[model samples]
Each structure stands twice: as C-alpha cells, then as structure tokens.
Target: MQSPAEDSTTHAPTRDCDVLVIGGGPAGSTASTFLARRGWRVAMLEKDAHPRFHIGESLLPMNLPILERMGALDKVAAIGVRKSGADFPADGGGYNVFRFERALDARCDHAFQVRRSDFDRVLFEHAAGEGVDARQQLRVVSVEPLACGGSLVSAIGPDGPCSWRARYVVDASGRDAFLGGKRRIKRRNTRHQSAALFSHFEGVERREGVDAGNVSIYRHAHGWIWMIPLPDGVTSVGAVCYPDYMKTRRGDSEGFLMRTLRTVPEVAQRMAAATRCADVHATGNYAYECTEMAGKGWVLVGDAYCFVDPMFSSGVFLGMHGAEQAAGMVDAALREPAREAALQQALRRHIDAGTDEFKWFIYRFTSPAMRHLFANPRNVLQVEDAVVAMLAGDVFDNPRVRRRLRVFRALYAVTSLAMLPRALRNGLRRRRQSRVDFSGETLQAEES
Candidate 1:
C-alpha cells in the first residue's frame, strides 16, 4: 500500500457525502452498507484492494446473526470451514470442547473459520452492491474539521488526489487508529501487552468428525497458542506471548514460531507433518484503546476504537457489531444534532459493556487460576454455560447470561484466593514480562 501522502499537483474535485468512512475493513464496510441502504450518501475508502490477506480468521457463533442480517451469511459459509465451537487443553489430558449449542442462547449455534482475504472481500463487495460508493486503494491522507460543521477528508488514489466534504466521519481504520493516533488519544495497554507470530500450514492433524473445525487453544508458560482450522485443509496457527519471551528470538520469525509450537506438546504433535503454506507474520505490542470513542463530528469503531486480545476470536465480531451499532447511532445523530452526544455516549457504553466483560477474563487468561478453571470447568450454578455464552459473543443485554457471569467472576475470585501463592507468583511474572522491552517493533507482516 502507498503512503497517504498527497501530491500537490494531482488534486481532484471534492465530493460531498453524508458520511465518509475511512478504511473498508469489516467495520467500515458494514457501516457503509447500513448507511447507504438508509439512503445516505455514504462513501467508503480502502487503502488496499479486496481479497487482501488479514490475520484474524476465526468467528464466534454470535457473529451468525449479524452476518444473516447483512445477507452475507451464506456467502461466508460457502467459503469457510464449519467451526462448531472452540476447545482447550484439559488438565487431565484430552480436550474440553465448548460447543456453541451449549450456550444459554443456542439460536446461532455455529460459525465459520475463513481465510480473511475471502471473508473481507465478501463484505466489501456486499457493501458496494448495496449502493455504497466504495472505492479501493484510496488511502485517507487528512481529516480537518470544518468551521461550519463536519470535516474535509482528503486521500490519494490511483487517480491522484481526491477529497470529500462529509457531515460525519466513521473511523474504522483498524489498528492504524487514524484519528486516535492523530489526536494522541491512543494508549497502549499498561496492564496487558502481547506479541504474536503466525502462519498457515497444511498436513496439520485435525480432530475427526464433529470436532474437526473447532478452534484449539493451548496454554504455555509464557503465553498461549491457537490452531484455527481454515478451509482447504489448512490451519492458521499462531502463538501470542509476552514481549519478554518474544524478545528472546534467536533467528527468523518462522524459526521462532516453529520453536514456540514445539514447546507445546499438543500443538507440536499436530504440526509434526505440517508444511508451511504461507509466510510467517509477526506483530508486537498490540493491546491498546483510545481514550475517547467519539467527538463532535465523528466516531471510531472496531480496532480503531480499542483492541484487547484475540484469544476469543472477538476481533471481527466486535468490529462488525460496533459498525452495526455505529450506523444506527450515526443515523440518529444525523437527524437529531442535539442528541449526538448522547448517541455517541451510548455507543461507547455499548461497545465497552461487552469489552469489559471480555477484559476480565482476558487479563487473567494466562494466570494459573484461569488455566485451572478452564481446564476443569464445571456447571456449578450454570457458570460454565454463562462462560460459553460470553465466549459466543453474547455479552450484550442478556440478563440470564449476565447473572451467571457475575457468579463466574465470584468463583474465579474465590479460586484465586485459594491459590493465592501461585497466583501471586504468576502475577509477578506477568508484570515483569510485560515490562520487558522489544526495542521498537509494532504489528508487521513479512514474507519468508
């Protein structure tokens, strides 16, 4: 992708739109589709062309409803591997699978594991089909607030420089956090920081029958690993570890990824005969969130607003869900200027409500207590089912699920107290590990 820098001589005419969406990933596409369907003059700009490679490939059962709403579920399913649920290593050996059907809400019982290249293109094209003036390879260069209201957004595309006068802006630029970074509101998470290395592979052993498509997770001393079954007999395997452990790399990222996989007996066995089919990708210090989600004329959604961890495969769901909600909020705000503040506030609360629930578990995911509980989950007070619901991305507006989640948190607290000594040791280790520096590397994907 070319830089967003514009050439002075290539200026094109400025277009007018009700909403100018930056970035055409899931969030941007969904928002554009919804707005355009509502008769708004919506324009979406994407830095890269469709069918581009992206890392997050897993989807939760909760995502089914949204996809169905957008009329793209069938398309996604056709190109995806059927993923019934997720699984984790059991303390007593074997694996403990949490089927989506077992959750409190079983209506959306299944999801698909897709190659994001295909998945994202489907959504982007769907948006264009829905009347959005979607354009690719247009990197937004600047967004300056207009004195009369709205903003002027400029970009440089194949046709050279172009601009848009937009009433409201939707910043869905993924991890670039365009507006957030520009305003200096993006903050790296202090409590939890992590790095990852991943690649696609073939010949990796997959579970048979009903479990063949489940995402497998294994906990290691320094971090955790994920094995997502993608279509075409390929698996997306990745390890998310602390910066301290990642900084110990002795060679190339591929070697480091292979060595990390070998450390986990379960993953190593599965990948023993696997042949890498793609280049190894590396990313570091990815956990972060913007202090503000919205302002006078704009709102941020998906990774542009905040990102915690991808342990539960919430990235795509959260992004699309936020876009769905943001579209509504933006619609209402456009009609009722006096209510814009309240609408943006509600949007932030809505996104954060689910995010906070996930954060509680994510912050403690690598702890001994969390590992023990997950490995030996019980249905005591139906807490396990509630957890399954949470994992399914059902964290919003479910009273029954919320009640049980509270119980689960209490249970976790008591368990932590019981394992106080071990908990303390793990906490200290995590703190020390998080403080370790990796020079100055951020998220980056490279070839072999």
Candidate 2:
C-alpha cells in the first residue's frame, strides 16, 4: 500500500465507485476525503499532477477551521507563512490593515499564505490518506449521466484511456468547469468582470514584524493589484485589470504586467528591487456561473458553480466549504433517492446565500463610495467589524454578522449618494470596460 503522503499511479481500465470526483484541487479533494471517510468508495481524477503551479495562494482566516477539520492544518502550517490580516492602499496616503482579529469572530484571527502547488498537494494527499483513490495527470473527457443512476465517465490518463461507472459525480474542476461548459449551462457574469496577470517574484519588500505576512492591495485608475507574501522570500504579485484597460496591452505579457505594476506607485516602490522568478500567467473571463449547481446524479462545487472577483480572497474558502456541505447532502441523497431534488435545492440555497453576501460587496468594490469607506472605516453599529468579518469569510452561520452586514449596506448606500457624481463617472467607465472581450488564449497558451 502506498503511503498517503505518496501519490498512487496504479491504474484500472474500468472500475465502479460510489463517487467520482473531478479535479484534485481544494474542493474535489475535500469532498472526496469526506465521502471516503464516510465509507464510500471514491475515486478522484486530477488533470494535472500535484505540486503544479497555480494562482490564488492567499488563504482566508475562515479556512483555518476547515483545514483543522480535514487534519491538514499542521501540514499547511509547516509550509505557509502566517498571515494575520490584509491591507489596501488608502485614498489619501499609506495603507489600511484590516486585521482578522478585528472581525466579530475571534476564533478566525489568522490564516496562511503559501504557494498553491504546496497547499493543494497537502490537501490532495490528505484525501488520499483518508482512503480516496486519488490519481493525477488524468484528464476527464466526458461524463454521461445514466437515466437509472450515476454516470459513465471517460478520461485519458498517463498511460491510456480509462473509464469509471460512478453512482454520483462531483465536478470541482475550478475554472475549467468541465460539466458547466459541456452542458452549456455556464454563463458569463456581465455585471462584474476582469482579467488577471500574475507572477511570483523574489526580493519583493514585505511589511514589518507582525504585518510582514499581510497581503497588500493597491488600487489604480484601471484596476487593482495584489502583493501576497509567500514563504522562501517569494511574493505572489498580480494585477486584476478591467477588460478595457487590458485591451490596451501593446507588448508581451511580462512587459504589460510590469507596465501595469508601474502605474501603481505603491506597488512599483515595493518591487523596485524584486526579480521575477516565474513566467507570467494570465486568465480572462474572470467571473462566471453555471445556471444550475446540481442536477440529477451530479453536483458542482467551487469555481465550477460560480466565480466572482477575488478581491476579498474568498475563492478557496467558498470552494472548500461548499464541498464539505455537498458531501453531506450527497451522502443523504444516495440513501434516499426520492429526496434528491429537495437536498439539491437546500444545497443551492445555502451556497448561494454565502456567495451573494460576498457578491454584493464585490460588484461595488471598485466604486468611489467603496474606496472611500474602506479607506476610512468606522464601527457605527459595529459596521466596520461586520466588514472585517466578511473579509475574513465569516459570512456563514453568524446571525450577528448577517445583521450587521445589512447595516453596512445601508451605510454604503448613504455614502454612494454623497459621492453620486464620482460614483456615476466610475460606473460609466466600468460599464464600458466590462464590454471589452479578452479571450486570453495566447496568454495562457504561451505558458505551456
């Protein structure tokens, strides 16, 4: 038997399993681990091998409890830099740090930042430890749901073709959203959109002492930039630019990214001595959602269901948390087939509620009112604490948080009214920018 810390390359041409999870990222691994621990025969397929390069290295404070629950906290802590808060450039000056401890939930006071290659492998390996049949470098080609039950999945592994007959399917394929794209249920989010260019750098300046590990956010006229401190003195830096600005790129990805970084004085200053250690990567169609989260014998988790702007670093938390909830619902549905529809509905409602909470803020994040409020926060009726809680991904299960968020929204509306002229001007620019289309095909292909 292979150790959980070791990847298994054992193969089978045909196999039957209770659950087939697509993608070995956070969501798929988390779901497979939970189902396997519940005694279900589970098989997880990953398109790429572990320790692969990926973006989204920053973790939210709420992710800590989930990691502990999955028994991978220590493994992650060993490789990740302890991140206590996030900072964004202020309207008039330096930066404002929103420490996790300031959030309403005291338990979620810190998180970690690591290279996604290492972080994802820890979770995937943990799932394998929990009895999941985890295999990598297997690209799922098709999933055909049977009328009776389950699905017939076809994939190409490292050696040759393979197939599986699964009683249920979970598509946690991150941004690929395999089922969503194949089934034609995925739709671009028109209200909010962006394209991202990111790379890792060595020698980028970090904050001092306790704040050294904090993620710094800088807002520019075109969009925003993120400077995330990772271990080994490598920092993950990226710029999320609106399509209109992105369409203005005249040169190579690296040159364009460097130019964009230079536009933000705060980021340019910090990177004055930094050296790019990795090739630049870019992705377009930054926001999208599937029309349906679950249907019949299949369910979608993480970016497969929906993806918004990552301004708040909510992607991983949302994906992993949804997977945890999905495992329970799927387990119940397997035993009571008649309640499948009801269970799926409940799951959709729960996931949508959490996503929408972040969406409200995300859609308005780049506006004049939001910029001013975040720059000058207040605790009137504990609204600032509520915003802090939301930043920490504590939107679910906290009645006080939910109640205070409503107050914060009301305050935001008042602020928008006060800054109506600037709000109207920025909104027009955003709308125009959102209309530009950027396939990002060349950018992604060059990476290969």
**CA lDDT scores, all candidates in order:** 0.89, 0.89
Candidate 2 residue lDDT tens string, 77-145: 999999999997776788889999999866778999989999999999999999999999999999987
Best by TM-score: 1
Residue 254 lDDT (model 1): 94
Per-residue lDDT of 211 in model 1: 90
Worst 10 residues of 1 by lDDT: 439-448
The sequence of per-residue lDDT tens digits that candidate 1 reaches over residues 126-180 is 9999989899999999999988999989898898889888999999999999999
Give candidate 2's total backbone clashes.
Answer: 0
TM-score of each model, in listed order: 0.93, 0.92
- In every candidate, how many clashes are there? 0, 0
Which sections of candidate 2 miss by over 4 Å?
Answer: 1-12, 425-448
